[model samples]
Target: MDAVQGTLDELGTPLSEVTFVVFDLETTGGSAAEHAITEIGAVKVRAGEIIGEFATLVDPGGPIPPFISVLTGITDAMVIAAPRIEAVLPAFLEFIKGTTLVAHNAGFDTGFVKAACAAHGYPPPVNPVVDTVDLARRVLTRDETPNCKLGTLAKLFRSGVEPCHRALQDARATVDVLHGLIERAGSFQVHTLEELKSFVRAPTPEQQRKRHLAESVPHSPGVYLFEDERGEVLYIGKSTNLRNRVRSYFTAGETRPRIREMIGIAERVRHIVCTTGLEAEVRELRLIGQAKPRYNRRSRFPEKVVWLKLTDEPFPRLSIVRDLKDDGAAYLGPFTSGRAADDARIALHEALPLRQCTQRLTERTRRAACVLAEMGRCGAPCEGRESPADYAVHVENARRAMLSDVGPVFTALEARMERLSVEQRYEEASVDRDRLAAYVRAAARMQHLSSLTTIPQMVAASPAFDGRWEIHVIRYGRLTAAGVMPRGAHPTPFVEALVATAETVRPGPGPIHAASAEETECILRWLESPGVRLVEVDGDWALPSGGAARHKARIEHAYRGLERRRAAEGRPLR
Candidate 1:
């Protein structure tokens, strides 16, 4: 496979194998629309050897300005007997056919050529234009030439002929500068004509030079890794079309600075083709978590997630923690940030008088009551004002809010926010709104994840783009195996084979067992997408009647409102 991949790469023309026509033009003035070509010169070359030379004088059908006559030795009388531009353009275009055009400051010369074609009923030449001036700027240092003017570069490169403002002389000098730049570019590993063009256009020349690394990637959906020369994964990504996505990093559309820097260091593109886009997404998340590639900002630290834990102490309090254990404590998250976990904890505290402190509490452990108790927030459990039975109610409510339902909790907060709004305390109302949103969203996610993770083993299918079925075998919320059934295939046999070969996942603790929350979330997303069907299940696959999924519309409505409010305040929505 490595041999095949190596053979399939390097799909670019080498500079030594390319034919080039180095051309220059002397015009009556700067603008092609108003000026006419007074002289045209070109040298066709291949492999550092000139194949042919073309030079001709053209009558402008107007008097030459004295300044232009002084710049070039050509006088009005010199072009009187020469061919007209209309008569000379056909042969000039033909002379440069089937070659890449090269010139100093090529835009000006090419602009004139294109204008001539448009005016004379001729098609504009489609040749790729290489500007030696641009190439010199990319390949040469300021100390090497000070400037990229044709005459200065010619002298710096020790060209045998110097540019004398005549078309043929300047063209010859530009050919030397082009050769010098190409040789200099080879030091940067830009040996191909495509690399040369990319070298000039790409923000990082290394990105263009390694473009062939994407050649071996297929057009199928998959995960791709940008690996450095040492075989270390620099960045990991996934796309529906691996080839196109990998190729896009080298194009103008990918403007992210970090990604461009990753492309510069990447030596090759390695890919794993998956059966479906969902599978690709799952693999990308898992790989990024495992590899912890420096270039991948998301999904690299799944363990760093914080959970809102309802501690099983005498007075169970809401505490934000990093690890989820097999203990009896109920957990609400998998929240990606501490601030979100804190928000959820505050929202619960607002509804129930759960203690907000970090100290461990006991049925008999008496301590000084904090301001929370004085403010009628907590039940003063630390000072033994509240009994175990009384606090148990808050503990059970917190568990219900975390695992099963959050409607009453949201209602309590909504009532508070409404009262605050009636008092014209808009800021206090907004705070309540945010805390409510945080708790509702976290509870909704927990329910969605728990619904899938509780199932031991399951087989599901969704309609594929073709007349086939996209089947997935899931175990403990992990995508153990994925396969596609052909249009007329037997479901039983196909599902049997897929299940037999599926990965074995022993159920682990927590709602997202044997997989990261992001991974399970990806699988759940696929399962909930339209047309998905549960082919078989070993256990219940139902969500609770009071689950957050039941209140999905309200959650969505709340989220949209939050987005609008934050947008008006110039803050991030999430």
Candidate 2:
């Protein structure tokens, strides 16, 4: 087996290979939208060597404020003969073409340039930008510099060129500050331009001392556990490269306050190496559920997950349930919350005439009809007013609506909404629309889940970055097992291994149930990702064209429009 490479593959351009253009601008005011540029200075550098320089004073087409003139020494007379911004901007854009733009408080400088470009009717340059102030905040502490001002950084880095409120000289000072920050970042192993851009959280001295904890971790795809002094797990995470990922937690790269606190309490770093990224992800989910680590926010309360089930009875009714069993019923969730389950149930009731009562009804059973039946909302099976045969037809219709067809339900809801709108009951119409949307959303989710569950066995593969294929064996839409196959290796052996090691996950209580919603969603996301290939499928796996899936997008779009109108009118959206 080949060793799995780290997640941060050598894909991004290395820092040494990138060209940086450090620039500075002296403006008449602080607001880029309101201010005018007085002077521009830029230096183009590659691999620590200056290759080009640009400096110019621009005529603001207005008077230079005396305070600004005193500060920058760029008087109206100095720029009296200088070219206007319309002329200077184009040349400056050409000078920094195909290079990362850098400046202290980059937003201030880049904002001015972009505004100038817009005003000149020129398309703004799309080059990547780097902000030294942001970079300094990530790599330096307050003790290193009182603030992230250009003058402060110049003095801290002891740059040979001191800033004297002049554009060109300040640009030189920023160049030194950029180099100093980049060199300091090397200690954290941030050598790629991508890493430098993303580096923001500064690691404390305590975290730096614990760097050795990651040294022994393998540079392979796996899950890592952060344990406190008592050997209790504080958090669990997965990554393509165990070593690099764990090392990141001990560096400035880890930003979340909860994670920082967890790291401070973490005494040991442990790992479980996996053969493929899929397996690593699955293991991480399983571990988080099992350990319920303090820092793991999601997937920790799987037991609390609820489902909307259509009861297996003569008059099938929908109810919210917590556990799934091998009962012959149709289920629509593993909904994240009780409120969501209730919303889906209400949507179904609005479209179907199924009974809402809890009493079991037989041919001879007798009970008073509820208000729902009195209002013609239910078939009144509890009162024996509806025959078993007739109720069975309604049950079948509800079943079809939940599992196969949903057109009638949406049509009914839409007609009701239209009637309410014609009556000028806008609030009632809105409520009807919301119920309709909920039904569509739930139906779409069920359809997606149904498409997968219909398959008994499936073998899916996606190309991995390390010249291998990530193979997953899914049984009943739940990941039974997963493995990696070499680029040119035969599938027979890997397939056999996957089957032999496959876990036997019991199907949910209902025939439609597969797994927890979180796990199913994870699998769905991976299957929908780019480059996934279906190696083998034992049964049908496809979405229905005429089902509620077709109406989801249109309904969601209308819902968004309604929300915007409500927000504009300052009306509460319910």
Candidate 3:
């Protein structure tokens, strides 16, 4: 029986065999941010045997309050010559390296340690922590113990050492309580450390192992990155409250299979704090576009965007092209897909009589007209039946429709849809309605982007949650720099500093000249959102008078009418 038990123990997972550093800290007060550590005590154990012990008096460099001195024995006179936290932190950290840390209420002790590390310029420890109080609650019944406090659990478990409001004594008592809880936990078949943590339900076992990754993330707007062991980025995301958002991924509420797989593989979570949620969103899009991380599905393929171009020729034709050039031709899009560009193209053809042919047309060089000429849909500019002077009118109108006015397309498509609906041609009406909707949507988007891209620079501010202002500097529609302005501070200096350090954007050939369409769209949404106040602008920041704004209402009304009709007739909407 002894031999068999030895063999089983040798093969068992790590909980029974793992080393632990049970530590305690006595501080001048409760808040780690406000108080200073006065003493550190730790006991390192393995397999219920003490391997080492460390105890030190830390000179807090401040006078301890009389009440604090009364709670814990040490006073101002006792710690005056003690080593500073900076001098003792390295030794304490070295002793506890690569071991699970345990304490009665871990946050109080660990917060001070983390605060010391941050204050003294040391990286915070990523060691897994086991809180004895939490473990006791999970494993011990109310009948077994009235409370999970250190002194209460220590007495119930019959610990050899009693806590007396001193660092080393409390640490020794916590070690005993932790062992008692572990022994009780084995009755439920939780032998391994992972199983023990699972028994405690530390959020979840896998995420709990790495939940320390989110400890440093701030509770502010930011972008986050999940990276693998090789430091390769696996996912990039943004959030309004970065700490809360990152922590949510490790909880049971996160149910996405792909994300769960990502969590298992992720080793570190990195963050970039932003001045506002909008900047974080824009940065997320830009980083995803640049990194093209394996897990991010958006902003991956900017090169595939298609546009509608009105060719500059003797007899101009509307062409769907993949490239945007600064050659004085009217361009309409950064359309995501070729199919969407085609829909907009069809809508333009339905509204205007422009020649559609693969062959180029010159006034002197005439070719044969196709079926479109016979149907009177085209002016037959390719066959000399249309003069260049007359063809120029169609081309000009096409340009105006693409760049400034989508009203004609809206009016024509609406009339055609009404006629088709009256004749009971529902499918054709739906198709025409979709086509015109696509054109109006694209025109409105382009006009909105053009309003920002044409401006040389702009400064805007919005109120922050903390009674301050979040300011941004934009040059040619690209966000350059962001900063916070204190309440009641003068804006001139803050705005000037931001502008001086802002990113230098050189405008290019498209509707969104200095940034990707997604980035510009995000910026536009932020600008248009409530509470944003424009501080300064170098040029006109208004949409054109003849742009597609008027067509939006018509499209919305058409959609509502279609929904009402479908509901009445019991038809599934396309």
Q: Model 2, 243-285: lDDT tens per residue?
A: 9889988887665445666677888999999987777887888
Whichever of 1 and 3 has more lDDT, that candidate is 1
- 481: Cα error in model 3, Å: 1.4
The residue-level lDDT of candidate 2 at 391 comes to 86
For model 3, what is the error of residue 80's alpha carbon versus the real structure, in angstroms, after optimal superposition?
A: 92
Q: How do the residues 333-421 of candidate 3 rate in per-residue lDDT, one tens digit apiece?
A: 87888788889999999989988786777777777788999998998877778899998888888998999988888888878876765
Candidate 1 has an lDDT of 0.81
Candidate 2 or 1, higher lDDT: 1
What TM-score, over all chains together, does every model reach? 0.61, 0.60, 0.61
How much is 109 displaced in model 1, in angstroms?
A: 42
Q: Give the deviation of candidate 1 from the true structure as CA RMSD.
A: 20.4
Candidate 1 stretches greater than 4 Å from native: 1-209, 419-428, 549-574
Backbone clash count for every predicted candidate, in the order shown = 0, 3, 1
Those runs of model 2 whose alpha carbons end farther than 4 Å from true positions after fitting are: 1-212, 251-253, 414-438, 465-467, 504-515, 555-574
Query: What clash count does candidate 2 reach?
Result: 3
Candidate closest to the true structure, highest lDDT: 1
